[model samples]
Target: MLYTAYRKYITFFLILFIRLAAFSQGNAGGNTVQTVEIEPGKSINFKATSTPGSAYQWFKDGNPISGATSPTLNVSEPGEYKVLAQNNLNCTSEISDGFIVTVKTSVLVKQANLSVEKKSETKATSINDPYEYLITVKNSGPDPATEVIIKDILPEGLIFKNMTMALQGKFDYNAAARTLTWTIDKLNSADMSELRFVTEAVNPGSVVNTATVSATEADPDLSDNSSTDTKSITDLTIPNVFTPNGDGVNDRFEIKNLEFYKENEISIINRWGNSVYEKKDYQNLWDGTGLDEGTYFFVLKVKNATGTWQAYKGYITLLRSKTAQ
Candidate 1:
């Protein structure tokens, strides 16, 4: 009986010892993560060591990503990303240290320049005219650029009339079909990003139009810093016709575009070499009353449209009604 009791006790002790070992291990079994990384398209995965029954959780920008309770995360966009893994035995593993994974976009315009022409500004050459100003914008990057947004600020007497490419402007703006558009797919490095627009100088004077052309990429991280340029609107044109009918509107008989003429001299003389009207301004006119109710000889001394100063002779007829007395 004593021998039998001793054997039973020994068996019980061994069983207890085995159970204890397993219990301790189950509670403190090292459940720790090894590595974490982001794959293409913002996907994430992690490897770890320890208890079974995998529990996966992903985080982005300090917010728990839903449905990411696995060892891998398949994301679509870009943001701060991380992951956590645990085992089924209620033993949690240490989180993997956060690593940043960013998807970048291609570059748009690389070189910048300005041009002067008739009616427009452009980045490339299509139709060069002395009657228009063309400001050239060239993109020397390898990446295919997205739709580009161009905002051109105009100067006094200079108004943007038309654009060769698709574009929009303030006041007369179209938000849907706005600015120059380049696909965001893939812009090769040696590609050109350009926009050419036309302008007309109203009422003649000195005009300087400043502008900034920016090439935009679709990606947020690599798309904010855009390209820029500055240009001037210089087209020296002279007015072709003027009327002096004494109607109080354009009543002055003088050169139209005399502002940019540098130096202008006008001489109106009678038949006896008597100067009746003479001035260097655009607002000077002779009513033809100094010679009486008859024909009077006149001469004009001024510069021609080609910047040549010379003399031109003409005649003026004055009629006096008897009812004037």
Candidate 2:
């Protein structure tokens, strides 16, 4: 009878031990359902809670995934996934709540081709003369462009006066930096816009103005992104007659627009080819002082900072009396 009682006690303890072990395994590691989103060409990694000396098994949609026994799984396709963990003593945990992955549609990029052209209304200009420049931006593409920007910086010897008009955008000019910027919200395919920029000539030389265009879309061609316009400037107006009779009107041997050329030399010769008067860096102040009333020859040489001296020979008839002969 004692032997039978001992055997019953052993069976009761065995059942209790099995129940405790099963409870411990259920609380070891598990998680709720998670949702993951990815693009068409993108992927995501699925991870499971890891325990020491534990093996893993993954399932997709209530089916066991073949050869997917790692703690982390690299998932590229959309599906519902679940994982289970087994300890060293062969105790298996409950299946996890798992994950729900959804693939998102891919978005295509916009492609566009932008070009710019700059041209001056006049090829030649004089100092302090106002001129106009036409800047055009064109877009040729299968898609529209956004946030279009055009930049045109005036070079030295040119001063920005103002913009005549802008077809489809706003322009801002910084006088101190000589920069003109235009911004457009959107530009449709096969469409074009223009800007008429007016400027004044400050110095005498070749003024090259370059304008460039850009947009928020991918550009296939870059060859026509920028355009350059060049202009030649000069101002040397010489007079043939002058009266140095102390009168305020026409009193000096003044050369119109000669002040624009800072480096210049002038010399006056008599009918006998004798040098009567000469001056360097002339300020148009020659009044034929201490000279007789007769016809004389004058030679004027002027040059800019980047050029050699250019000579202009002419005849000057000096008249001091109130009336001519």
- Give the top-scoring candidate (TM-score): 2
lDDT tens digits by residue: candidate 1, 1-325? 7545443443333223222332221222123222233344454333322233357677777788878676545555666565555545444434443434455554444332221112333311111122334433334443544443334455444455565552222223333433322222223344443445555555433354443434444332323233333332223222222334445553334433346545655555656777776666434444544345445454434454667664434454544443232
Candidate 2 local lDDT, 1-325, one digit each (tens): 7545443343333223222332222222224355668888788765555343268788888899999997667788889877676656555555665567889977788987999999987433557868799999999988998999999988887888888989998899988898999999999999999999888887866788789999999999999999998776667656678998876878899988788778899999999999999999999898988999999988888886668876667688999877555
RMSD of each: 17.9, 13.1
- For model 2 the TM-score comes to 0.45
Clashes of 2: 0
RMSD score of candidate 2 (Å): 13.1
Candidate 1's C-alpha runs over 4 A off are 1-131, 163-188, 193-196, 203-206, 214-325
State residue 161's C-alpha deviation in candidate 2, in Å.
6.9
Give candidate 1's whole-model lDDT.
Answer: 0.42
Deviation in Å, model 1, residue 95 alpha carbon:
21
What's model 2's overall lDDT?
0.77
